[model samples]
Target: MNRVKRLIKSVPGSTWAGILLMVFFAFAAKGYLSERNIMNILQSTSALVVLAAGMTMVILLGEIDMSVGGVLTIAATVTGMYLKLYETITVANIMIALLICCAIGVAFGLLNGLLIGYMRFNFWLVTFGTMSMGFGLAKGVTGGGVLSGFDTMFRWISTGRVFGIRTCIIWAAIICAIVIFVNYKTKFGLHIYAIGDSEICAQNSGVNVKKTRFFAYVLSGLMAGLAAVLLLARTNSAGATLGEGYEFNAIAAVVIGGTAMDGGKGGFKGTIFGAIFISAMKNGLQLVGLSNYWQQVLLGVVILAIILYDVINSKIRDKKSLRRVYSDGI
Candidate 1:
């Protein structure tokens, strides 16, 4: 009973409920869910899931990273540039380019962390500034032009399959595994929750709040770089304009996955389920012949509704916690 109670307390309603809703809609769309469709949903959600997983770490520290989308574009461009320069990119070349891309993203993320985490600047304000600067740099790097036709080996990461599963899906599953392990099994994850819940208290408790925030942002940026690779590989194109609206979708997935925007509570599993649910929602709507415009509008509305509920749920939990404390004292 204690173990079951603990498990129930660990995975909240908001986290799993959205997934259930999506599954319900998916079933409603077809007489029976197809295996191909399930694979397609997972494959399409691959990049977003990776993005959200990284963003989950950042947001857990009560921080936001709007520059992730821009970082994605920059990473893809760097990889594409390497592919263009070399007839065939060696594994070392790919690793180096990816490193450079992530390093740049880390710098951008660190900038935001320094300004917001230590300097006490507002999270939104810092991210908003970095977002424009990141995009501007991406534009400058590509000379405001779209770069297309990437190498075949590179495309395999996005388009190819392994043992009947899409490569991207496999990558996403691996990322999810890593995220879950780190966030659930490590001390760093505990610090994330501690800082998110209360920075001053966490600091008093010896948690390295500054380092946690900085590392979280770096993780977010690295994930953006990874997603950029996936996007470029799948499309065989790299554009200065790529990943324009990725931040919104990534945040939506995290929120819908049951992660708190205000921070302190949530997990990667919810975000994983959330990413798949959101992708299925979009795909299912398309299958029903809904236009893209309606899909965007509906997705936005659904996310907003779920977020509002999350806010209320947080408030209720806060009240309940207060009550418990008072009751114990009495």
Candidate 2:
């Protein structure tokens, strides 16, 4: 019983909220617990999971990247354009296209890192500028058109199933696992939390705060690029608006997962649950005959509620800590 109590105390409140939501939806929505519906939810959420994983890292480092959606669009556009020009479906060509997409993503990420980390530019302004540039580049490249005709194998990467599970979901799970491991087990991960907690203190402790921050952006870009590829594969088409509003969705998922906006306090476990919860909420609401507009409104309400919960929780923790200090002093 004590062990159970300890475990309950150790888990974040957001996690508990997610559990309650799952239970509620399971009873509230017909067919919500069906295998097919569950798989559909996971498949739909795959891309968002990848994006949120990266966003979690950025937010953990006390920064934000508003350019992921733009980066995703631009990368997908470039890949689609490449495939269109080649007009050939070969393993080598597909690999080359993917590499090109990732390269573009990394390049944009590195630029953001350099400007923000080295030049000490404002994170929001720099990312917003890059976001606009990315959108412009995508529009110019595609001439405001959609690019299609990708190879069968390329499409299969997103659509194919392995053991009755979507390939995209498998890919997302692997990426999330790698990120969670890095966040928990690696020196870089520790440094990320440290820098987020207190940059000056981390710098004094010999952590390369700037380099860590730079790499966080790079990771975010890389994930966005990979997500772009998957998204392109799923849709089999790329347009200027391929990634529209995804950045906001990713941010919303991260915040809903219980990660603090100020940084240094959340884990990927909460994020995974958070992503799943958002997807489930959307699916459940639709199943209940809610319009898309109403679904979005409810999602906004949920986010606001979560934020309020976090604020109240933080204050409670502070008060508890103060009491502990007083008792210790007495």
Candidate 3:
């Protein structure tokens, strides 16, 4: 009994909320719990989980990366064009295209890191600027049209089954695991939390604040690039809008997972659950016959509610601590 209680207590409140959400959906949507629907949810959420993992790191540093969506679009667009140029796509060609996507993403990330981390530029301005640049470049290159009909081999990167499981799911799991390991077991991860908590103090403690911040954004870009590959593969289509609104979804996942906007708290574990929760919410709502517009409104409301809960919960804990301190008279 004690062990069970301890296990329950160890789980975050948001995790319970996620479970409740799934249960509610299972009841509300007739087929929500079916194997097919469950598989759909997992597959659809794979890319999102990967994207949110990187956003988790960025949020952990108390910084935001606004260019992920744009990066994804541009990377996908460029890669799509590369595949289009080839009449017959080979495995080597697909691999090269994958590298192209990641390289573009990393280049943008490096630029963001150099400007914001080393040069001390405003993160918002720099990221947003790059976001616009990425979107604009993709649009110009594609001439405002969608890119589609890539070779089947190219699509296999995401749609192929690996050991009876979708490749995208495997990719997301591998990537999320790596991010979790880095966040928990690495000196770099410690520095990330420390810098987010107090940049000045971390600098005083011999942490490389700038380098950490730089790497955080770079990781975010890398994730976006990888997500673009998955997105392109799943949809077999790339367009100027292919990655639209992704950054919002990624941020929503991280925040919903209990990562503070101010940073220095929360881990990727929460973000993973948060990503699934968001995906489940969307899938369930759609199953419930809600329109996209209503879905957006509800998403905003849920985010606000979670933030309010956190604030109230923090105050209550503070009061309890104060009462204990007073009673101890120490």
Give me the candidate number with maximum TM-score: 3
Q: Which residue pairs collide, candidate 1? A: none
Q: Residues 96-175, candidate 2: write the lDDT tens digits.
A: 98898899889889999999887889999999998888888999988999888788888888999999888999999999
- lDDT tens readout by residue for model 1, 1-330: 989976765555555555576676666777226898778788889989988888888877767788888888777877778778988777777677667766766777677778866777887888877777767877898899988877677788878989988898888888889989998889888899999899999999999887888778777877887787777787788867888888988988887888887789887878887888788888888777789999999888888777776677668778989999999999
Model 1 regions more than 4 Å off: 1-24, 27-32, 313-330
RMSD of 2: 2.2
**TM-score rank, highest first?**
3, 2, 1
User: Candidate 1: worst 10 consecutive residues by lDDT?
Assistant: 9-18
The worst-scoring run of ten residues by lDDT in candidate 3 lies at: 6-15
- Candidate 2: worst 10 consecutive residues by lDDT? 9-18
TM-score to native of every candidate shown = 0.87, 0.92, 0.94
For model 3, state the Cα shift of residue 248 in Å: 0.9
Which residue runs of candidate 2 sit more than 4 Å off their true CA positions? 1-13, 327-330
Q: Candidate 2, 133: how far from true, in Å? A: 1.8
